[model samples]
Every structure is written in structure tokens, then in C-alpha cells.
Target: MIRLLACGALATVQDRGRLGALRWGVGTAGAMDTLALAGGNLLVGNPDDAAGIEIQVPPFEIRFEVATTFAVTGADCALMLDGVPILPWTGARARAGAVLRLARRASPQAWGARSYLCVSGGIDVPVVLGSRATQLRGAIGGHQGRSLQAGDELPLGSPDLSPPVAGTGLVPPVVALPLAVDGLPALRVLPAAEYECYRPVSRAAFWGEPWRVTPQSDRYGFRLSGPTLTPLEPLELRSHGIVPGTIQVPHGGQPIVQMCDAQPSGGYPKIGTVIEADLWRLAQAPIGARIRFIETDWDGALAARDALDGWLSAARRALSYLRARSTA
Candidate 1:
């Protein structure tokens, strides 16, 4: 078990996310940066989708009730365990009552917006709708279905006594697999159903310009400030099913990129959908940061997904070998 000593808003228990409940209109509320979560889990010897704490606002502090192994990943923050510095993405063992502190990012230029804290056993939140992720909008899962607060004591699953070799870590996915456009982080976007409705100039601008992530961005969606994407004519579409990564261009001309906690359906015009493989890059994009889009086709999107899968597979194999060598 671990107790929250200090926690900022939006920090909550999350797994891969609530899946297959969209028909009931439940949004998938999971870690904003899933690659970070998975990397932390791998360091702690947990399943790829194991539940962990997603820290959006930092200065988070927690105390281990029992001796356990853990890892912190994602944001390049100042991590301290009982006053001793711990490296991000590295696994470490904590004695009982040791306090873990995560300060704000060390650098603004760092590629991180969220961080993941994964333990050997994962957080033992009740499974709701086949997931442990907190559905904040529905108030259904996670700890009381809300953000964790000070003094919250979260239960943990049975610990994996033989954790990964201590101090071992994987290279962060951001560094391992990089994607950028003109020095700005980029996401592969496939043109959506309403792509043709936009004027030729609008399409060119969407592809050529870098969009700034506005302050209004949150778990729901990223409201982007960029070239006004005007359609050749006004468009009105019936509310239709949408998923995370759907980039909707509203009447205001600013594009809104749906995120993990976005509604199941939307009525806005979608100019493009960011491929699932690159959503993590957008998730880590800081507010006020500018990012560009790379136009892609169905085949390119599939290839990107395959590349991500290959990276995860290689990480798993490497970790397994390390564990075996340690025990030998």
C-alpha cells in the first residue's frame, strides 16, 4: 500500500484505459502518455497495461506503506526517494515508509507533460467496465472515481518479489522513436471524412503550418490555435462516433484534437485523425507548444503502429534477458 502525502489535481490511477464501453458513451480515461506508463510498468516488472498513477500536475509526494519496487517515467522531473535522487525511467527499491517526491519538470524544453509512477504490483483499484482507469466524466472508476487527494491510501496488488534488476531502465520512447517536422514535434494525420470540404488553401495551411496548443487544452481535447481552417462552404454534420485522435475543426476555425477523455461522439468537422501510434507524442506536448502534422495514408498509419509494437516487443525481450541474467 501507498499513501498520498501531497497530490496535485488530475493525478489519478490509470491503466491502458476503459475499452469497449463507448456504445454506452463512456470515454476512455487513461494515462495521457501511455508509452510512459508501459515503460514504468516494464521497469517494475508489471504487465504492459498495469494500473499506475498518472501525474499531470507535479509536486506529488507519496509514502510506501511496505517495502516495494517502483519506477517513475515520462516527465523529466526531479525525483527523490527519502532525499536520495532517483533517475527517471530507472527502477529502484523503496523501504517501508520511504517518501517519494516528484518535483516539477527540470526543464521547460523537455518533452514531457505527464509522468507515470508504477509499482511492482500496480494499483489495486476495482475493475469497472473492464478497466481500472478512472472515468472522471461518468464518476465510475479509480479511487472514488475522482482525482487522488492528500491522505488517500491506495491498495496495491500482490507484489512481484523478484523485480527487474535495480537501477536498470529503458531509453524513453521519445528518444528511441522520434518524430518531428521542421524541429517541431509531429503527429501523423490521415485525412478524415470532411477533408475534402475544406478549401485548397485551408488544406495546404493545415499541412504546412505549426499549430500551437492553446491553454484551453485538457484531458478532453487540445484546442489548437493555428491558421483558420475555413471550409469552401459551411458544413453541418450529425453527431457521429469519434475516438481519441480525431481532430475536429469547429466553426471557430480552431481545431480541437480529441484526447483520452473525449466524448464518444462529436458534431464538429474532422479534417484529419492523428494516428494512434503517434497519439503519445501529442499527449506529451506541453501547452503553448507548437506542433506540425505529417499527412499520411492508411498504409503509413499501419506501418507506424507496427513500428510501435516492434519497439514494445524489443523492450520486453531485453528486460526478460536482463532479469534472467540477474537471477543467473
Candidate 2:
């Protein structure tokens, strides 16, 4: 394992995100930029579920302890390998003491939000609630429940393994985010437990009005302000399990979309939910942005879920082919 010197806005290990144990009150805490994380996983042949780093904007740097290949994706950060330009969404070889830097610029992919960097070998960190993702609010997962700071060290899990720098993208990583992602998608969700209690007017308004993002949003959730929604009965429900993208409407009638860093259980009544496929874009949303929900029936949701399954299977196959070709 190489010794890593944290130089800038580095955070702890993340992956596709923590899963399964939410029933036990665990948050699906992980990388905000799921697409970028998967890109790194594909480069290194690690399963997509492996942990990586969710980096902030530019001036991101680190020193390599051992020889290995690493990849960075997400965000349009100005990237430098030993102070030279590099490309994101690609992999490169670094010897012991080699430095990596990501500087921000104007691009669409990694813009104004979370990005991901993955080492050939995953980082070895303590697991909480069966995940390495840091849940800051819980103060449980990740590296002591905080972001990485300068001078801090991270342990690489495997050191003996080395693969030649073999990838389609440039070495240091291109300082730009992927421009196209099919645009922001309308989240489709079935009504939550209290869906029936909403007045007809409030229910219609939910699918009708355009909600703008609130500045007070974070990993906890996105607070949106729009429309005047009223519950059929003004009764409060007990706090229960809340999933990522679940829309909970409180007293103001505005909606809050719970995110990766949201609490496991919430007291507010959840009116609707976001479609899972649309979540990646939502994670990158900036403040004061507009979003709308496109209502879909249960069958449509099932079709979307199945499509994702197909895509993941194809991705796994593609990775296998890449590794096999590189070795041959």
C-alpha cells in the first residue's frame, strides 16, 4: 500500500453507497457522484460496490507511497499530475512519491458538486453498520466521521498488485465533467405511507408545480419550495424509515428530498419518492435550481428498475472484457 498525503478537499472512502442495512437504521451513505465512482471501479476491476474517495473541487492533491494506477471521475476539476494537466474519467500510473492534483475549471460533468477518485487497490478503512461510507451525522462510518485534511494519511489495501496503465482516457485525468447525462430527469415515486391522507388539491399540485432547490440543502436532503400543498388531515406521523429521494412534506407544504446523508428514520410524512435512476443527477444539483416530478404507474417503475439491471450487467461484462484484453 502506498502512503497517501491528503493535500486538499478529500473525503473518506465511498462507493455505489451503503445498502441493505437501512432497515437497521443505517443510511445508504456513500459517494454523492455515483457515476464517477463506478468509472473508477471499472478502471481497476474492483466491484462497483468497493469504496473510493468523493473529492471536492480543485486544488485536490495527494502523494503516492507505492507504484499503482489510479482513476478520477466526476466534477470538472482542473487536474494535474505532478503539476501537469491530466484527464478525469481515466486512469494513469504513478510511482512512489508521484503527486496528483485536480484543479477546477468550466466543464459540465464535475461542476459545482461531488467527484470521485479511485486507487487500484481500495482504501482500507473501518466499517460502520457494514459500510465504509462516512455518515457525518451519525458520527459512525468513514474515517472518524469527517472530511480528509492536509497531512492526514490513508492506507491502501493492496500494494503488491500492479497493472500497466491501460485505459482509453488520458493519464492525469482531463479537467472536465461529462457534458451529457440526458438532462435532469423527473423523479417517479409511489406515494409513501401517508399518500392517501393528502387532499386531492395537494396531490395534484405535487405533480403539477415546479419546485426550486433551496440553498439549505445537503447530503441530509434537498429542501424545495413551491406550491401550496395541504394534507387531507393535519396529523403528524411517527418517524419511520426514509430512503434516498423520498419527498417528505412538513408544515410549510414545501418538499424535502432526502439524500444519501439523510437520517435513517424521519418524522415528516413522505408524500412521494424519486425514481432511483434519476438520483445521480439530483446529487449534483446546485442551489436554487428547478426540478419536477413525472408521475408514473407501478409498471413503469418496474420497467425502469429492470433497465438498470440490464445496464449494470452490460457494464460488468464490459469490464471483464477490458481486463482480459489488457492481460492478453
For candidate 1, give the lDDT of residue 54: 91
Q: How well does candidate 2 score on lDDT at residue 72?
A: 78
Which tens-of-lDDT digit does each residue in 73-132 have in candidate 1?
A: 987888999999889999999999999999985575666889999999999999999899
- Give the per-residue lDDT of model 2 (tens digit) for 1-328: 5344544554666766778877767788888767667767666656556678887544567888787788777665677778777776677777788898766676554444666778876766776667788877667667777877767677766633343345545221112222222354345667777777889988887877777789888778889988877887796777678788898988888889998888878889888887676576677666776767777777887886675555556655665666567778
Model 1 regions more than 4 Å off: none
TM-score of each: 0.98, 0.85
Global lDDT of model 2 = 0.70
Candidate 2 displacement at residue 260 in angstroms: 1.6
What is the TM-score of candidate 2?
Answer: 0.85
lDDT of each: 0.91, 0.70
How much is 92 displaced in model 2, in angstroms?
Answer: 2.2
